[model samples]
Target: MTVETIDTVVVGGGQAGIAMSEHLTSHAIPHIVLERHRIAERWRSERWDSLVANGPAWHDRFPGLKFDDLDPDAFAPKERVADYFVQYAEKIGAPVRTGVEVNSVTRLDGRPGFRVETSRGVIEARNIVAATGPFQKPVIPQIVPEDADIFQIHSNRYRNPEQLPEGAVLVVGAGASGAQIGAELMRTGRRVYLAAGPHDRPPRSYRGRDFCWWLGVLGKWDLAAPAPGTEHVSIAVSGANGGETVDFRALAREGLTLVGRAERYANGILYFGAGLVQSIRHGDANYLSVLDEADAYIARNGLDLPEEPEARDFGSEPECLTAPIRALDLADAGITSIIWATGYALDYSWLDVDAFDEMGRPAHQRGKSTEPGVYFLGLPWQSRRGSSFIWGVWHDARHVADSIATQRSYLEYHAQAEARSA
Candidate 1:
């Protein structure tokens, strides 16, 4: 096979890859983006039809391009998001090779680069950026039984309530996806049950301003350190309008039965852990703490802002917090379908290099890997809290591109010095 060479090779042509490509193009770097499917394939194929961005359009723009024609505050639908990526790629004239799947990335033998094995062909690159994104595959636990009697689908596969089998539905995992899916299912008059988990609940809008706006102003997105015991805190937002709030409390109030964290499915029965009410309360407290921190920042800066909105009574409907059942037989509950919104797992099996830690996560400082030319992008808290989001990936991308350029310059300089001596 004839081997092709490039300055850089970017894997996965989603928002992260596209952003990285834009920076590389601006830097005049000869790089190619290899995507297994179409650009933003997750938005196109994995997401539900009704799914919209959890954040507003205004905040989701790429570095140079803004959402000019669309409403800034409106939540962009999945289709629009996919189109935006395509348009962005075209606008920048990105060297993106769609439908090209990368099989493995290994060091070039006795060389100072990487060999990227792909479906198309082999690509030798001076640098490689893994932009596969944070959400790689749906993480449905092995705990979910293999029984054929009940239908099961991950949130990525779920389209709408009408697509589900007749009868009640169990939505596992109460993060943004779970809360939104449960709420949507409940609207269809289906008996929706949500399994609550450890999550953060921030109101969609607070004090007549979008919570995201406050988070931006307060530098919440700039926070890089994770909370002591948590890997990352999931934001609770719905894509109803440009965006809306969706939390366990709201879902419970919407007539969706709230249950504890799903422990296991055994013998035709689903068992749940206790502390459903406590979990809701804990999430609410965490949300309040964030608001308090923002308020403190405003005060420290002496910025004249609007008066803080009166604390809304989140506890008004206490009945929703009650966990009436800890275990339910699948048949007795009349639940015919289960949607696993448990979250996603990042896979780096294609990386045939020692750049990962014992936990199987990339060992990198910021976005640069310990192994000279290898780098990572679109990782949660890779550089900051926004690193994983569409609006945030550009920051990390710019850093990676600049780092690659610097490494290439140093290598070229050394090569010239050695030639002069010769």
Candidate 2:
């Protein structure tokens, strides 16, 4: 079979792939970036129409690039963020080939490289960087049967509330996506119910600064990720309405029905646990933890930062928590649609390398996988808490590029030495 050969192949064309290409080019490494779709396709297609980045514009961006005349603290609209990646890729002359889908990656037979099989053709590379990212396949638990009466869609497929069928909406999973979508649906004069789960709630801003700034300054962003296959709690925060915190109490007052994590859907009814208050408290504790850390930092450093009184006030408990229901009859509530904001599952089945743990999570230190010449980028907690984020992913791409370059040089040196002896 005829096969194209390159020094390196980077899978994906999102922020991570493009960033990897930039670093590879800087290292004078010849490579090709294969993108299944257009650059930042997920941002353009997968996300909801009203979605805004959780991070502020300045903090979410790559190094030496601005989000086009926007203020530092302003949360960039989704389209603008996609445009920024495209613009950055073009500026850096990234070798991105769009619409080229990679089917599998396997080691070359008795060779020191990998064979990447794609829809276009086969390409052999000395090294491969799996930058497909954390959000791949949408995860939908089988709590509800396939023949359920209510229409269901994952957050990945949701565009806007208008697309959903008429009736009350039950949004399962109260992560950033679910909470924002649930709130948006409520604003459209539709009855919305949110299924609270284990998630951290961070304030949009603390002490006259965006939470992004505080995370960076306080070294929270430098926090390490848990071991591979370990589940991490979602951070439920939003950039909606310029920047707003999700106060369950406020959402409750605004007519949002808060329930515990969805247990099951049976007999035309949805069942929930009695952990509604505990779920809210989980978020409250996270919210308070960050505030306490920031406060201590200011006090220890003798920095004069004004304390916001309203933020610390966790008012009286809402009725939903005081009296949590165990079940919701779908027909009685007039619920016609269910949006599962249950997040995405990582899919590395196409990777024919022994670079993953038993749970199929990438088994690696930082971005380097266990298998030589096989690396992973943009994984959640791949190295740090910020590893999956745009900026953090970019930084990780640089590190991966350095590793590839160093390994390539070592291999070439050994090959030359063997040739001289021969």
Candidate 3:
């Protein structure tokens, strides 16, 4: 295959890739962004029909543009979000080639660049940024056998409740997606059972300010990743219902049976972990801790923010936590569907570089890999807690662009030195 040469090759067209492209353009770098689908395709296709942006419009966007038509506190619908990125790319003239899929990234042996193999063609780039974003592959736990009679779909493909079979649903994994979906199904008169798991609950709003604002002002956004395993764990906050706090205890009161984590399937029966109460308590603690931190910040700064009573009240743990369900028979409960919102699995199988950890995660320092001219973007906790969020991606992208520019200058300097020696 003929190789198309470029200075940089960005591997995604989503928020991360586009953001990286914008920075590279500003640096006067010659690069191309290859996307498997359209820009911000996940927001348009992978998400559920009712999904909205995680943060309010004013806060979660690039510096060049404000979501002009949207209110400061309002969360933009997913369609608008996709449109916003598309507009941003156009405004900055991002060179994004849609429908181009990158198959692998390997070094240009005995050289200082990379050979990116893609579906459309080959691209030999001096530098590469793997801006593939966090949600690469759906992670469906093997709790249920493939032959199980119940219908199953990952949250990536779930559009709405009406798409499922005419029966109750068992939603597995209670993160943002699962909680929002479970609540939606329950509202539509469908009997729902949610398999609760360890998730952080950040209030939708605290003292008249969005949770993101609190995180930013308190420097939580700048903080590094937490525990190793919890780095990828999603927060249980939803933009639906005009920004709602995902409280499992409240959902239980609304008739949704909250169960523990789905463990394994044996003898045609599903077993659950016995830490239902602990999981709920963990979310409650996180919720309270956030409120407490916000209150502390207000007091320290002497801000006039009023106390939010409801934000602090997460409700009492439901009985399911105390008397956890040991087993579940899908047929007995009339449940014919299972939605797996169990987060994503990191898939960098196409990376032909020694720049990953034992956990299969990219081993990079602030987006720069140990392997020269190779970088990773849109990763969880890449630089800060907000690294993966849309509002924060541009910061990481800028850093990656700076790294690329610096390396390019170094290479240019070395080439000049070699020419002088000759």
lDDT, candidate 1, 1-422, per-residue tens:
79999989999899999999999987899999999999999999998889988888878778678777678888888899999999999999999999899999999899789999999889999888999998997888776676648899999999988899999999988788888888889988999888887788887776556777888887788998777876755556676855666656555676789888889777888888887877777788877886687678778988676765654456455464653578989899899999999889889999988898889989999999888889999999999988898989988999999898888788889999999999
Instruction: Please give each candidate's TM-score.
Output: 0.95, 0.97, 0.96
Better of 1 and 3 by TM-score: 3
State each model's CA lDDT, in order: 0.85, 0.90, 0.88
What value of lDDT does candidate 2 attain over all alpha carbons? 0.90
RMSD per model, one decimal:
1.8, 1.6, 1.5
lDDT of 1 at 224: 83
Task: State the TM-score for model 3.
Answer: 0.96
Write down the lDDT that model 3 would get: 0.88
lDDT, candidate 2, 1-422, per-residue tens? 89999999999999899999999999999999999999999999999998999999889989958886798888888998889889999999999999999999999888789989999999999899999999999999899887888899999999998899999999998889999999999999999999987888988888887888888988889989553532667778999999998888789888889999899877998899888888788889889888998888889999888879789897777788889878999889999999999988899878999898988888999899999999899998787989999999989999999999899889889999999999
Better of 2 and 3 by TM-score: 2
Ranking by TM-score, best first? 2, 3, 1
Checking candidate 2 for backbone clashes, the offending pairs are none
- Against the true structure, whose lDDT is highest? 2
* Selected candidate, larger lDDT, 1 vs 2: 2
